[model samples]
Target: MTLDDLTVSLRALRLLAADFGHLPAPDVDVSTVFPERLRLSFHDTSCESLAAFEQWRTALGIAPDAVEARTQSEGRTRVLAAETSFAGAVVMLTAYADQSAADRAGGVR
Candidate 1:
């Protein structure tokens, strides 16, 4: 499916879950979906493995803003994997840095 389709589906999933009193996660640690992917944005970076995150963080002895984990499934099959930064409450991925920056600047939707 297209990215827009994926987003719409995800949003609908969250809303439907919320309707049943199953709210979305307030905080997410991305390290468990795509290990080794160090995503660096303007203010933060993240990885995908909890063990790796802990080891590396211990070595450096610093605090991350947050950590998130997600898993997408279809029946018994896993379909998607990803990671997000730890320092921000909100996140949006854009192909263009300018667009991402603009998105962070204000509510663009």
Candidate 2:
């Protein structure tokens, strides 16, 4: 996806926020889902991996100012959150790493 386009595409920017450090850098698939919607996918979907997407985006020098990120606790779960526009709708992209899934994968908790 074009960085220039991303600067103006708030929806795409928000979706990407939750996927920054979670996905492999410089090697991802981007697709347009509709008139103003986009989709991005990358490697590494493990529940054990934990990282902020904004860090990766900032490091790449392509992060937008529209997305705001923070961490919060839902009962006993820690969820990563990115609030922004998605597909013309205001939404918060939240990702929860499944510690149980990580345990099943032999990953240290």
Candidate 3:
């Protein structure tokens, strides 16, 4: 089993679905464009997104401080990202600002 294995990617996604079932569902990406990785992206306010990202990262056995947090869209959008390997597949978790957050901040809709 390796990151390039489709089976590994699917298995990782299934595990994530089971583990994070209580939280808001993320956008799951398992495209051939990135066959070696699984991308789970969440759109929520900064606080909510950070909380969810922490939970997912911890569940994947990644340290909280290992995350890479930064801002995008000219500092209007906050992005929290982290990557780890699960069951031999690379897993990347990313959370970005939702429309509501941007609207609240008077950003472009």
Better of 1 and 3 by lDDT: 3
Q: What lDDT score belongs to each candidate, Candidate 1 first? A: 0.29, 0.41, 0.76
Where does candidate 2 clash, by residue pair? 20-53, 21-53
lDDT tens string, model 2, 7-68? 43455555555555465442333333332433332222443323434444343343465434
Q: What is the TM-score of candidate 3? A: 0.75
lDDT value for model 2: 0.41
Which runs in model 2 stand beyond 4 Å of their true positions?
1-49, 52-74, 85-92, 98-109
Best by TM-score: 3
Shift in Å, residue 50, candidate 1: 2.9
| Sliding window of 10 residues with minimal summed lDDT for model 3 | 100-109
TM-score of each: 0.19, 0.27, 0.75
lDDT for position 2 in model 3: 50
Instruction: Please give the range of 10 consecutive residues that has the lowest summed lDDT in model 2.
Output: 35-44
Residues 1-109, candidate 1, lDDT per residue (tens digit)?
3444334334433443355333212222223233322231221122223333343333323345333322222222111122343222122211111223333355332
Task: Residues 6-46, candidate 3: write the lDDT tens digits.
Answer: 77778888887787787667788887766768898888754
